[model samples]
Target: MFYSFIFILFFFNQVKTKSIVSINREANKIIKYVNNIPNNTWKAGFNFKSKQLKEIENIMGVLPINEKYTQSLEDLGFAIHHNSNNILDKDFNEIEVLPENFDASKQWSKCKSILSVKNQSNCGSCWALSTASVFSDRICIATNGSIDNNLSGEYLLSCCTGSCGRGCNGGHPEKAWKFIINNGICTGGDYGSNEGCQPYSIAPSAVELSFENTADTPECYHTCTNPHYTTPLQNDLYFASKVYTVKPKMKPIMYEIYKNGPVVAAMKTYEDFFHYKSGIYQYKTGSSKGDHAIKLIGWGEENGMLYWLAVNTWGTLWGMDGIFKIKRGSNECGIESRISGGLPKL
Candidate 1:
């Protein structure tokens, strides 16, 4: 009996030692990766330290790089509902003097309407989340803080079918706005709440940062059928009418956010972006793999570096509390290229 027990203990110890060695090796690799990123102003470290090093690396590897724009916008699901002739003739022509500085989160403190940071999980729903976030904030601002409610990204992802693209595959912000203007969206909280028509199906906390990718895009459900929830009243439903693109310039983009609320921006993201922690992020290296949509809420200068304050949908744990600073003005990563938003009809 003593020999049998000794043999079992020895076997377990061997396994434990191997595991420790493997972990140490992965930790070293991550450290090396952080060190090797050229001219990175931001710091990169394990945000999810509780996870095994290998698991974290796997998570970093599998996180869906937004590759939705590779095909034509129509093929990617952006269907145009309105007439094309008068599309560019909309009210986005308003010109305003540029401010030296502005921060929406600080200005709207009483409303507390500026949304808390959100996570998109493993899905390619940044397009929907970014649009819904901007829509939610704009509705609150336009209504003088009375209509502050979190709109549903899941609704846009699933229901905004023709132009807004598919749930996990990818989507476009402009198409999402068009859907909001026409159909209207209900108020749904994050993953768990039954407050709105359709709450986000994926739980941010339950996401696995491993090699096996299990999250799948859900089907579009037009009606509010969640037994625990009901459709919001017509007055409670939010919609917009004047959707326009901000000219890809510093002054114009700044003016739109200052006058309205937040705007959705499409940015070219590289491998380096996945490791962002803090500091003004500029595309340092790595191949331009995909495009990501985010809400551009405000802009500021940090230590002489001007940066745009972007709220990401990767939850509060991913970037700097789910917020990232991109180098502004220079249009780094094509951020200024696709700045778009609309006035919320109060």
Candidate 2:
């Protein structure tokens, strides 16, 4: 009996030691990767000091969006809706002289919703959040900054039933826009803000250094969550007249933003992207984490390296106050590959 007990203790001790070694290796890998980055192009730091690799994976809010499954606006025959003329033809007259730096928030300073940096909380609803944010920004800009309202991400997260993809698990940006055009989204704000009809149901990850706990998608509801909000569900909705995808090129994207407004873009995010603190980000060392969606508000050059300024949905605690820049023009992480925006129905 004594020998059996001794053997059991020894086996457990070996397992514990291996677990500790594994954790140390993961943490050290992050530190070493950061230290070895050349030219100081960007800064990185840890949001979650995780003991396991899976913990880090759960913090990311975007899923692998399959382009094969989601249909584009062109596929839906929106080209004719714009009078059969190329969508780009209408806006290029003033875009001949592209500025070195452009910010949509500054261009339309009265459109306060353009500057919002929202927290998707523990939900992997970045697909819904970024699309909804861009939709909200366009509405304000379309109305000449007369209607500065936040459209509900929670509404899209729950109600986009078909091709919009699964809520919290991630959805297709194109489908989300389609839903906005067809059904129109209601007004909502961040968690507990009560500024809109339905605030976000999921709370943020709680702290900067902790692993994210996953959340189930909230139940779809048409009525406003706030009792004080007297607007009916039908009356509160905002619609889009037309939606279009930008050609995957630097100049076209620049002209699109300069003529219209900010755009929602999807990029292939890496493990090192989560550690981004400041400066222009180029994928350094790390394996593919998955895809992420972000709002591109502007572009500028830092240290002679051009970058697109983007807003992330991980709250102000992550990145540079929920903002980060990726190396632009080169299609870094496929950032420029898939971009979409629309005009609002005022």
Candidate 3:
């Protein structure tokens, strides 16, 4: 009986050791698979271990690539008509001065108004996240860093309605700006934190398999009442006075970012974006995924490659510390197609 007990313990230990070895082997394969992409412009490494590799592509914080959504750009939620008053036509030569190079991260770092990078988790709410980020940055710039407040993407996700499109599933940045202009949004932090009017409902690391078929859009609410806890009244809400779209071109878009601070821009994303690590990202070859809205903060040149420095909603673990550089000048990935934002009303 004593020998049998010892054997049982030994057997369990061996089984556990074997399971660990198997997991390590699988992780090595995933890393090799990423490195093997032919002529890959960017590097890819493991953000998750082997056991989670099957879901690795989904865990990168991007919605799955869908051909149907890619075929129709309008379905991505960019408004067709923008307010003409806010349009900065080419005739306005005074505002068209493009510097040799520019980088907002460096320019605004001293003021502490540079927008903080955020994560969207499994929710397909990049539209709201991008808009809120730009809004937060603009408020800081407009106030000369005096009122640099972290605006709430959660308020936009759960409250912004009408033409803003459905929350989580997908939405438009311009429509979100309109919502903020019409109905103010309160301060909110990430999920699981009640620091604001309404924290993000979706928890981080909740991977969604597909945006089109599986993800459910959260219902919109007008108040900041969380079902789980009693919260104090939130009076830290802000609004925008004007929201407008920019023409999809290099000069105008650059001018907007240079003059007005960061603006939300929607661009085509691909399967390879999930594996991006470091390098100037020009779309190589991959299935064209749906559009993603990002905050276009600045631009610079690297080894003769002119790139746009955009802040992604994914956390700092992905890309160059939560930021990415895409080939500029040529409007790579249709990035220049849809750019829009507005001024903060103090």
- TM-score for all models, in order of appearance: 0.75, 0.86, 0.74
TM-score of 3: 0.74
Q: Which stretches of candidate 3 lie above 4 Å from their native place?
A: 1-41, 47-96, 110-115, 206-221, 225-234
Residue 25 lDDT (model 1): 59
Over the stretch 1-346, how does candidate 2's per-residue lDDT look in tens digits? 9999999999999986787677657656865677576776887776544442445555355555454443354576443222112546546554467889888889999988887998876677888889899989888887898899888999999998556777877777877888888899999988888878887888776654334456788999989887768898889999888776777788778777777788878888777787788889888877787778899999988889999989999889788888888899899999998788878888
Compared with the true structure, all predictions reach lDDT values of: 0.69, 0.78, 0.69
Q: Give the candidates in order of TM-score, highest first.
A: 2, 1, 3
Candidate 2 TM-score, true structure as reference: 0.86
Model 1: which ten-residue window has the lowest total lDDT? 56-65
1-346: candidate 1 lDDT, tens digit per residue:
9999999999999986787677565545654676677765566655443233333322221122244542343353433222212323243355444555678877675445475676676667778888888888888887778877788888887787556666666767777777887888877768876756677887784433532353576777666645676544454467776676666777667767887778888887765576678778887655555778888989988778888988877777767888888889899998887877877776
- Per-residue alpha-carbon lDDT of candidate 3 for residues 1-346, written as tens digits (9 for 90 to 100): 9999999999999986786577566555544665676765566655433333333333222233234533333454434434334554645576545786887766776434354777786667888888887888888887777776667787787676445666776776767877888777776666676646666776665332322232345666666645543544345668887777777777777777887788888887765565578877876554655778888889888877788888888777778888888888898887887788888888
Q: Model 1: residues >4 Å from true position, as ranges?
A: 1-40, 48-97, 205-207, 211-214, 225-236
